[model samples]
Target: MTTLDNGTNSTPAPTLPAKPAVSMFAIGTAIGAILLTIITAISVGFSLGEIISNFGRKNSVVEGLLNPDWGQIWSRRSRSAFIETLQLAVLGTATGATVALPLALWSTTFGNPNRALRTLVRSFNNVIRSIPDLLWALLFVTAVGIGALSGLLALFFFSIAVTTKLTSDTLDGIDMGPIEAANASGASLTQMLRSAVVPQILPSYTSFVLYNFELNLRASAVLGLVGAGGIGARIEFFRGRGDWEKLWGLVVMFFLVVFIVERISVTLRRRLI
Candidate 1:
């Protein structure tokens, strides 16, 4: 080694290689994503525009809404029809929710000790959920004849499917630590679920129930389209006679009732969650 005057040979300072040209890659990716989003939005906008144009030409929607017959809505017959709608919703939701509780519990692995049983229960729940409410209403209407009872049955099945799905999901998402603690303290499965899981998931359960109630209200209003009963029947009656004013009045009344229910649901949900 050659010795320098003062000393020690030092390694040359390592030069940092120039950073790879990643900026171009990042910019290109961002540009591509933006372009894709723009294209998608334009496509959706065009489709919506076509729909709006079609609706405007028909004039059914706007005419019905703007020239609603407020006098008809305030009439005794209309009020009675509205009340029937409310009754169908309330009774249907109550019965459905009651039935759903056991199904929801059975559908979840947390409640079902046997894996095979859990799978079977979950499959059954899925089958129920796959059927749309309108289809259910149509089927029940044929079976029970066109009346409020048919509407109630349709709503009941719909609510049960919805509640079971939601409740099972809520149960699955619950923290298991509390449940384990309860079990460790010599609690039975039922006791653990009642004391620990239920408390944790009650808020979510209540919220789902409220949501189902809102859905049931809308469903009840339209059930009469299939002759299942409620204001839907009244709407269909007027529609057949070409009484656009009365039809519009029923539509407006439905809108008002749904709006009120929505407000109450929101307030209750806020307090809950």
Candidate 2:
């Protein structure tokens, strides 16, 4: 409002320009999420009442968790199963993560310039990733006949999916200056990636491998359910016999080892990154 200096006259206040409204993209995202939630709930038959009615009921899972036979930790079978699980995890992570590195690099433009090859690699990676660890185990078990080899194969594809996705995310954000300089100096694609790209993401890549190992260790415990081998087979036996206490004990013992390894891996990853 403007006021006259020596008079009682006033003019209406001038309004400043309006600030921008919320973005359509943000609004659309919110709307889409709400719609998706609604659709998912409907499809899944989500019901709070069902959960409310069931929550107070006694369950074998709860009983097992409450009364785990910790003495099972000393069983020779348990020990052997645990060792097998560890071997499966180590071997699977080693093989899968090795292949994942090349696959991750090839999926990027700077690594594999061939559009068709890059797309194929990306599509394959995506397909492998879309399948869950359990499903992989089932497929491998079917193909190879229920054994540790099948479990190893499951973890292999699983580790590839995990490591490749995580590593590829880092690749796109690497410092491109060195990449350009390497190319400018007449280095070949493989040499540039090895020299320039590898150094930048080695820490992250190693960390991903370690993390994938941790996951494989945990997953290897259940692969036995599908006869793919490892401690999972013991778990299935315990479950089938309704030996909840022993089953829980085996599960707990396995996880304790996993917990310790994960702690060590976390420390290493922190040091790497």
Candidate 3:
């Protein structure tokens, strides 16, 4: 406090606190990341000059990319492949999501009474999630032979992994009041879960299922390379024959379809959540 010109007491302005110093740990981490990136780039023979020169050179692949055959969209074979891809995505999401809910619930302590069973369920979920979607497709393809059946099976397991993981995370945060109430009221385990748990997470579960469908649709294309069956197989066919024009056309159409579906899914998910 200080005396003003008119002899009235006045307070001085407050001083702001000094900012904290950067930590040694953060500095070390940044330096380590930079060193790692440089080493990796060197190991991979990264060359900007080569990349630019390659792109500038006249090549059939580049030419075909520039002049895609748009008419492939009208081809009956392409259309059939597109439909098959859609079917795989739909069926995979449906079946996978259906099984996922039960598995997710059973893995939880409140849902499954047996500790051994819960541990087993958790282990299964972990194993499924650890495997990539492409590997699943490849395994199924080898086991079932080249066909749509393999693609469906691959998507099924993939969907289960995705939806179950997401749903289980949601379950962890649910209100326990309803669950405890149901248990105190002499409800069976299944009854308690149905009345208390399903209602809480159904919206999130549905949103996850929709998101999984999008993933399945994109994955179906790649699965075709393994002969699991879908638009990917057709894409692979064009690639094998050096038909880049047709391949690019299919890619463009697929992009358009994916974009439209993504918009719809986003809208629905926004409403759900």
lDDT (0-100) at residue 215 of candidate 1?
90
Compared with the true structure, what per-residue lDDT tens digits does model 3 show for residues 1-273?
A: 123332443546554555679999999999999999999999999999999999998998888888999889779999999999999999999999999999999989899989999999999999999999889999998988999999999999999999999999999999999999999999998899999999999999999999999999889878899899899989999999999999998988897898899899989999999
Q: How do the predictions measure up, each by TM-score?
A: 0.78, 0.87, 0.91
Order of candidate numbers by TM-score, starting with the best: 3, 2, 1
Taking all chains together, the TM-score of candidate 1 against the true structure is 0.78
Which candidate would rank higher by lDDT, 1 or 2?
2
lDDT for position 204 in model 1: 84
Candidate lDDT scores, in order, read: 0.85, 0.92, 0.92
Question: Which number leads on lDDT?
Answer: 3
lDDT of 3 at 29: 100
lDDT of 2 at 210: 94
Task: Give one digit per residue, the lDDT tens place, for model 1 in 1-273.
Answer: 223322454655554555567688899999999999889988877576788789869666567777878788677887898899999999999999988887887777667788998889888888889998878889988887878888899999999999988998888788989988998899887887788778898898888888899999988889888888888888988889888877887788688879999999989988998
User: What global local distance difference test value does model 1 have?
Assistant: 0.85
Give the lDDT of residue 263 in candidate 1: 95
The predictions' CA RMSDs to the true structure, in order, are: 7.8, 4.5, 3.8
Q: Which order, best to worst by lDDT?
A: 3, 2, 1
Clashing pairs in 1: 147-228
Worst lDDT run of 10 residues, candidate 1, spans 1-10
The deviation in Å at residue 112 for candidate 1 is 0.3
